[model samples]
Target chain A: MKAKAFAARLALALVAAGNAASVACAADFDWKKFQGKTVTFLANNNPVAQALLAHKADFEKLTGITLKVDGYQEQQMRQRLVTVMNARSDEVDVFMSLPSREGPQFAAAGWYADLTPMTKGAVAGDYDYAGLSQALLKAGTFDGKLTSMPMNIEGPILYYRTDILKKCGVEPPATIKDIEPAAKKLKACDANITPFVSRGLKPAIAYTFSNMLHNIGGNYIANGKSNLCSAKGKEALATYSGLLRDYGPPGVVNYSFQQISALYRSGRAAMSFESSNELRTVMDGGERLKDTALVPFPAGDAGQVPTAIGWGMAVSAHSKQPEAAWYFVQWATSPEIQKRMALQGIAPPRSAVANDPAYRKWIEEEPVRKQWQAALDVLAAKGSSEVGYPIVANPESREFIGQAVQDLILKQKTVDQACADADKGLDALIAQK
Target chain B: MSEAAATFTEDRQRLELAALSAPAVIFTVAMIAFPVVYTVWLGLHSFSSTGKQSFVGLANYSRLLADTEFWHGLWVTIALYVLSLVLQLVFGVWLALVLFHAKRLPGIVRSLFISPFMMPPVVAGMMWLVILDPSLGAANYILQSLGLPPSEWLASPVWVIPTVALIDTWQWTPYVALIVLGGLQSLPPSVYEAAQIDGASAFKTFQRITLPLLLPTIVTATILRSVDLLRFFDIIYITTQGGPGNASNTLNIYGFRVGFEFFNIGYASALMLTLTAIVFGAVLAFNRLRGAVAW
Candidate 1:
């Protein structure tokens, strides 16, 4: 009987030790904890996504989680994300976002997960939370809600043809006051070429036009009323539309970023105003890249302020596996990955990547890249976050602003009439609870 | 046969027929009736994209009535329906006459002519996107070479609807032609024979006899085509996305944007139901017109 009792006690002790070891293992950080689980990431077909997809195996190996990415064009991707989220589905655990445009609407609708806890808690030590730009982080935040993590900061900048500008004996403008005169000189240099090209499509034009509006010291909304008819507002509208209307290409009325990029690349436009992120596309060839130069939007009476926006990776509130999703987000937005993406033409949201040795060296050696980076640096530091009205009905609100711009360009309505009509519409939209 | 035995056999046959068709009946109800009932039910309630719903008692309908875009979209829908119908019918009948009278054409040639009708509408739109590209399109190149001014076909706000209408006509006219061709081929030979005997010219005979007899077929074809035209979304969407600033916003595109893009489910439902009513009302009016016209 004594021998049997001793044997039982020894067995019990051994089992307890084994259980304690297992508990210790669980407490330690283990990437493989979510092994064999699957995550679906909905991505837009952008430079960041392309780089992420190219290196997806690294993530899967680190986490042992199967990753499936459904990539779509930007517009289609947003529409799909809205549909999936509005259905309150957990099918998609992680997705890409342009927080500047949709942050308020999405956060208000409770479509995005509040990431503050994760940012400060367990994932804090693994992820360098301070590495990202505070401005970009604030852009991703809405009404005290931290909904997304910033990835890239992009805004419209001037891309001018050096050969054309030089032949015309005109120097680059340091302010908006100089653009009109320079445009005339360039137009005189070559009648066959358009002097300027920019997005004229409604809603889309509002994006680039906001930069112009900012330059002249105008605001879209103030104190819950439309401020588009302010003296500076009229100046911004008339200036932007007048540039395109007077010296633009024949079909400039319908031009957006795609057409504007094509025009500049085709050597049809001497100067193009487009997104800073379009370096890869605008710099299509080595020779063209050499001739091309990027400059900050010229300063106006107020100052040189451009409108900038940020794209981010976000977890859905209804995610079935929030931890696994965050692991993927953190791993993707880490310093090393961001540096890699920046070298490949995506504007980095993290200061670490911007200060990385290799990225800085590449910018120093590459002439076209040097100019583009200079423009990005200025805009990143000074750009305004309110590209359009930040409202739940943001898409609807843009139409009012765009219509005014469109009417100005098409010569269909007077500036006063356009603003008044748009004001009525905007006032009504603002009245919505 | 005895009366009792005969009655029993008839009843057994009836039961067997019902048994054979039961699957089809069930399928029709599942596919068609259920969705329609659900759509109507949804139209009566205010709903969010996340499936949140509240009864609002015709508020959505009243809102649409007050909305200017709704009325504008309806006007645009009617304009497209009428314009495309006219172009398709005219070109369709003309092409049918040519194909019907010309027997020497090779089978390959006829097949090539019918190819556009076989192409998907979205595919056709994309193909035209290349052909109508303002900078590098063959259409503009040819025009410039011919010493003519190049037109901004799809880009121009004033020309988008008409250009889209023309593209639609190019695609669907063949379908209308095939239908009218069948009607022409099936016509009684005696009428033409009588006209020839009376020394009537070919044009006169076609107008007096062939057209009079073919009116019913043409009317039927127009009604069918008009129904399709009122719901036109794919080509316009694939081409312009109702752009250059709401210039080409059609009823179908408007409703889709409201429902899917804007995520206002109740308003979208009301828009679609109104569109459906428009389609049904148009068919009823056209049928009445057909009845009034004597063949």
Candidate 2:
């Protein structure tokens, strides 16, 4: 009889505790409100998706909602999303997107759900939306619609071998104009190592070339017509080609990110201009880590235009449960989750997490990581998210520009001639009604 | 039986014959005719990546007509076709003759020679990708070790097409060899015996006897190889993606890019159909010329 009475008292105490916890949770946020619901995320097998997948179970436990992630290669994921969005199907609740490339196109087609209202909802307090990078906010926002939430801001970054610069008695280039001299000096120091390398493949070439074009004050279009024939375009092409032709390794024309990264990592290349997203691949751990230095894309003569583009998360406009989907987006991008991912070297989109004492502590743990963090802080502050033409023909337009670059590289056409040809072709493409 | 009943029985037999053939006829029309018909219909429209397809008759065609890249793609396709075919045939005949004459371990050596042909085209291309890598590849490493300057095979525009052709030849020459080997074996041994009786030189006998009898088989091989080569895609797509600046872009690769990469369904449809017409016209012309050959 005494044991039974004690058990009853214990049950009563547990009930009281449960009620207090529920009241507190309801007051701040009720994560269990969407219990038993499921959300599907269509993602690419990129570093961002891999990071999310690594710690997804914690999110599920916190929110009490099941998550289904469908990961694919970059191209295949886009193909699958296009099919779903075109069908107006709600099968995919959330998807990974490249906002700088497809944001305007997707929004104009009514494929992206407006996320501004979702951000203003009841869970807004937990999100800390203002802490996200202002550059990312502008990139993901098109025509006043928040088409997506920034996941990562990746773009061209200059990685140099500090030892090589020291050996050459040269300073790291502070501007695009300084590259030719620095590279020449590095080559003179060591005839063995390639002094510079960048992507030369057709479509991939257009990516870095766009940064050079903009830094030289050349724009993609002028007065609603192709403007690559401008004098700035010629100079940009000459500079890009000249760097590769003069100091780049033989067969650099076939180089893409894979080859360039491998060359740099294996100590065959002294300097490389590649996406910052590749930090983990080349700099994760190596004997050469101590000699590596990271910097914002060397400032261009036109100004400090660093090419930055990013992957983002978006809700399909045709989603059946848009509010519930927003819950997943909000939870994934929460400050706490961003902090966890940031610890693993993912460039956080939130200013608070990036500037946190904890993040600084993490950086100070290693000399190489400190340089990486410093470089990222500068890039997050100043890089332009415009990496390509903003027209509907973004991809098609790139092929033409890439061809012009290749033609110049191969000496098939003079810079003026190639750019002229490309301009005419792009004009025809733009005028295709 | 009476004559009328016999005639009715014959009519029943004919009906049974028609019923037996119906499934194959239906399958052919459904499998082949539907896609062709649907593609032609789509080719007449204006479709963007959004799938908002609308009828815009002849515009995609006229646009392609004025497009310089499309013509360049066609020329590249033809060039790769003729070049790969010629190299494969030349090496194939020579290899087959050697394989046919080998009396010791012929079977084992022939199997080893045919191994490359067993690999899928995509797999073959991937293998060559590693081998031809400029910085960290075995091909360049070997050249450098031999005191020879390593040539930039796929990096130089001048060398890209020829290098890809060489890689394709390495994989596909055996396909030609196997086909020609069968033809070589089928030739009467008596022909060689009779030539030997006359004391003709081995070179003369092969020149006069072997080549004449192999024309029909060689022509058949050329036509088949030609069709495949004109629409070549996988190797180039994997290796250079017709790059170093459109150095090796072909008709099918361009068509696939338009369809999948750019998502311009209507234009891609038109491009593929035009390629089909070209292939068909070329095959017919070749077959007509084939009729006049004495084989």
Candidate 3:
């Protein structure tokens, strides 16, 4: 009889403990009020979709709100959002934006609702929202107003083959100067292998080159003036051109990110500068590239800096249910949920989740994650904004810069001449406004 | 009384005729005329796709005059149109001639030859891109197997334009061939028979008889192909996207980039109007040429 009584008391105590934990996990706000409301969420291609899908049932059960998630390619999403925003339509309730380009433009246009009012008081204090990295949060801010929330923190990194480097008796390059010698040594070691490879074709080639340009203290445009004719800019262009002409694959002039990744993964190229997002693709189920390693983006004469580009979620100005949207945003970006996302190999934007013990265990086991963290560290120090020029508001800027790069690299035009020609054209375009 | 009744019936008949044609005329005006008028109006102003508009009056046109990219695109369009048209016509007429003389298994063979025209332009471009891909494309693989130097068909700036032209030719030549074949089959068989009876050799008969009789059909095919090829977009967009430094960008691609991609609607409108005028002029010139030939 005494033992039975003790057992019952222990059972009740355990049940109470479980109830208390569940209560703590539940959001402080009244989720029932949002019942019957439908929310549309838009995102660029990110793995967060899977996590949202996984927890969607729980959210619906708690709030009785239906969530519809839509994903688009980065550029397409940007164009769509711009069209809708410019038209002042409520077609999208929430949208994914990149800090460097879309955030500033959208914020300037007042397309994003100011979230400072929504994120204050009891709700803000209930959540551990303070753990977001200060630098990343600052990037998302525009003129002292918080417009968007960061989803994943990402920057460029050097992807290399460990086996190949070992065979060549060389280490991965730590700086821009080291790259050439390492490439030469690797080339000498293996004639069949491309020493270094990068995307040097039209349009997207400029994106890869921009990272290097930023590291070398080169600016595309500065102080409301075109600065492509600067000495640093010229040297950056020459270095990029020389790398492609001398060390890159034979037909790399027409390559893009996909082609560069393919070359590196296929063991045809020794190393490349690529994004962390491509890590999953490179390391998945391929014997040839399973041993790939990631490192910080090489340092330039100015310093080691990688240009950070990432997509973040922002509530549209047209949303009818700002409160409900906030609830979903809070849920999605919460430390608990972000930790879950990290376990599933998705890069969470929250600093707390990124440094969590559970998340670190998984990251340590994966070579790609180690590289990603290394790249992130370098980015934290020397990373610059992806925004080059406000004149790039027009999409033709991408094409114009891309053509200039092609002219300098493939057509052998002097950097000054090429940039001057491009500047002249872009000036005309901007002047038309 | 009889004269009044006759006049009333005649007036009623004229009214009926007018009423019968009203819907067709109204439909054309609404669908076609309104947009053309709107494009012209929009062309006169500096309109943005973002709903920002200002009256720029002839400034867009002036810009077009100084625009090097526009001029480059215009020349590329001309080169593509002329090259593709000439090659397609030559190959098309040759194929028509061969098919006209064919007998057994000719129908099957002709269907197979013209099958490329049945595929959509996007699909056709994708097929060609794969076949011509520098790295793993079947074309390069076969070249390697045959111990020949591999050519960077799409990568080389010098060859990129010609390569795109070749793709256009490959896909469209069959369309011209089919049209020309229809025309050839419709020709009176007795003309050739008469030439044969007159002791004319095959080549002489072809040059003297078939050539003269096929002039109208050839002219029609030329006009049709030229107009369509001038507006070429899909193949170029899919294959090279006008790249390796804008080597294949025609006026259509340029307008699309400006109007849609860059949101410069006013400039794009002006560019479109210029393209339309060029097309219209070419058609008029070709019609005049055909009239002289017929006379």
Candidate 4:
């Protein structure tokens, strides 16, 4: 009996030691565990991807993985992704996606591999998963599945010419209501310059206009129907259109980010509201570098409810190497790489990266960039991703919203009439769901 | 040869013809006939982006008939078509006459005249988008310098259709001129000699002889231009994306959005089918006109 008890104790001690060793192994997570694995990344050739790709050599060196990147323009990238995903081809292992735009749609289509397990099991030692924004992560999650990881946080922010505003003898706008007055003053001061600009194209208007719509306390949908006919909705529609109609550039209605950036960069516009992703474009020639200031769009009834969205890194559900893909995603969105991306003007999704000293020093180098970082901070704290109607038809819903605003800008209809028309169309789309 | 030998030779010839044409026949069945038949099949069903499909019969068609956007797209398509077609035809003939009279024009000058048409439509759209920008464009700058009011070329909803039509006319007028020039060259000089003997004025001769003789060529041009103009997509898509209140939303643009953006495949197929019917009917009518005017 004594011999048997001693043998049992020895077995228990061996098992405990094995458990301890495994725990230590997990603590020192292996970055090179997936060495020699290949990951194909479908990347949109946007600034964020450009920034990440610049440091791709570092990732390859650190992880020993062959990263094959297929980059295309944004719309073309989405089209390619859709075709590849629909065919259930394992051609793409990792891809960039805008979760706010296509998260639910892709999730419903079963195109996104659920990353919940990989995120918990395969993260690095200093991954600090909790450092990522909860709100953004929630945006990327659908039906309890973590579909993607946020790459860069962005939204429309007001980029104003300090010299123009000062020359026009106008104070900086403090509320959404003040923007029209400031625009008028700027136009009166100089008829040659375009006073203001924002997105007016049908598909792109939602990203900018949603800031106004949300700030004015309007909801895209309420009571299971489109609520564009609500009082605040009409108010937002009229105000946004009225600004462009009265003091905007002559073809303001055709302006999207590309035009808006061009106009602002040329020092011909007093104010421009465009995506934060456009910082590099707007600052390209360094002409407006000294005189420009960035701000979260001004307050309104809802008190500065900015629209914030981020492109995410998602492993394809059809990926033959999903776990390997997750390694790429985790490493790309890791604190160290994101810190590097943040210095290069990609707003990091992790709070820790934002607080990194190198990133802080980089922002401090330029006054405009400092203000940009400050505005992004505000966005991170209080932004919402409800750019359009939250439905499977969200992208289609934006068209109706843009149409209503465009109608008002053209004076084709009264605010009430425009809102009613939009609601009619949106209601049909809503019913489709 | 005997009768049996002759019959065998005929059979061999028939077999040779089939073997020679087999690739083209297979190509047509695979490429053209398959997609068209699939599109028709898609139109009769409700299809979702997630591979969910069900038979919905005429429901999509009925929805389209009631949809205001469809009617608006149709109206916009017709307006653009008529405006562009009229402008191209008038300018095409006038330029053709000018080129016909300039018998000693240099090859380089003729190439320059046709350069705009040679540019791809998307490139033309982008080039014009910059040149016609309301604020920073050279067009408005020139207008300002000349003490003329600058016009919102592509931005004004009231004028977007005309502006897009003008852009199309600018690009395709050269192509039309080339076609009309071909017709002018093919005309027999005997008619002109006879008119000269009759002491007919240039204007009078052109009205009575040239125009009447040119009607068939013009109708041919119209049929070709009309089919394209009715399904106009690229320039409008690149420049405005049928925006400024759906002012330039042609049937093709609307159909593309429905199919690709909304991924409402069933409804989009129905919309495209209707557009196809309209284009087909228009071509049929133009062909009838051409037959009536043929010499």
Q: What is the DockQ of each candidate?
A: 0.33, 0.56, 0.36, 0.65
- What's model 4's lDDT at B57? 90
Q: Candidates ranked by lDDT, best first?
A: 4, 2, 1, 3
lDDT of each: 0.82, 0.83, 0.76, 0.89
Candidate 4's TM-score reads: 0.92
Q: Give the TM-score between model 1's chain B and the true chain B.
A: 0.93
Sequence-dependent TM-score of model 2: 0.87
Instruction: Using lDDT, give the best candidate's number.
Output: 4
Which pairs, if any, clash in model 4? Answer: none
Candidate 1: which stretches are off by over 4 Å?
Answer: A1-27, A122-126, A361-365, B1-24, B47-53, B130-141, B193-199, B287-295
Each candidate structure's TM-score, on Cα atoms with residue i matched to residue i, is 0.89, 0.87, 0.85, 0.92
- Model 3 C-alpha lDDT per residue in residues B1-295, reported as the tens digit of each score: 6999999999999999999999998998899989899888878888553456789999999999999889999999999898888899999999888877775656677789888888999899878876876765688889889999988888778888888889988888888887788888888889878887899998998898777877877888888888888888899877777777888889998997777666667898899999999988888888887887672
Q: Tens-digit lDDT track for model 1 on B62-96? A: 99999999998888788888889999999989988
- Taking the tens digit of each residue's C-alpha lDDT, what string does model 3 give over A209-311? 7788877878777655666678887777777777777778765667776667766776677888776666665665665445677776777887866776555
For residues A74-119, write the lDDT of model 2, one tens digit per residue: 8678778877876789999999888877676677678889999777
Clashing pairs in 1: none
**Models ranked on TM-score:** 4, 1, 2, 3
What's model 3's overall lDDT? 0.76
Pick by TM-score: 3 or 4, better one = 4
Compare candidates 3 and 4 on lDDT and give the better one: 4
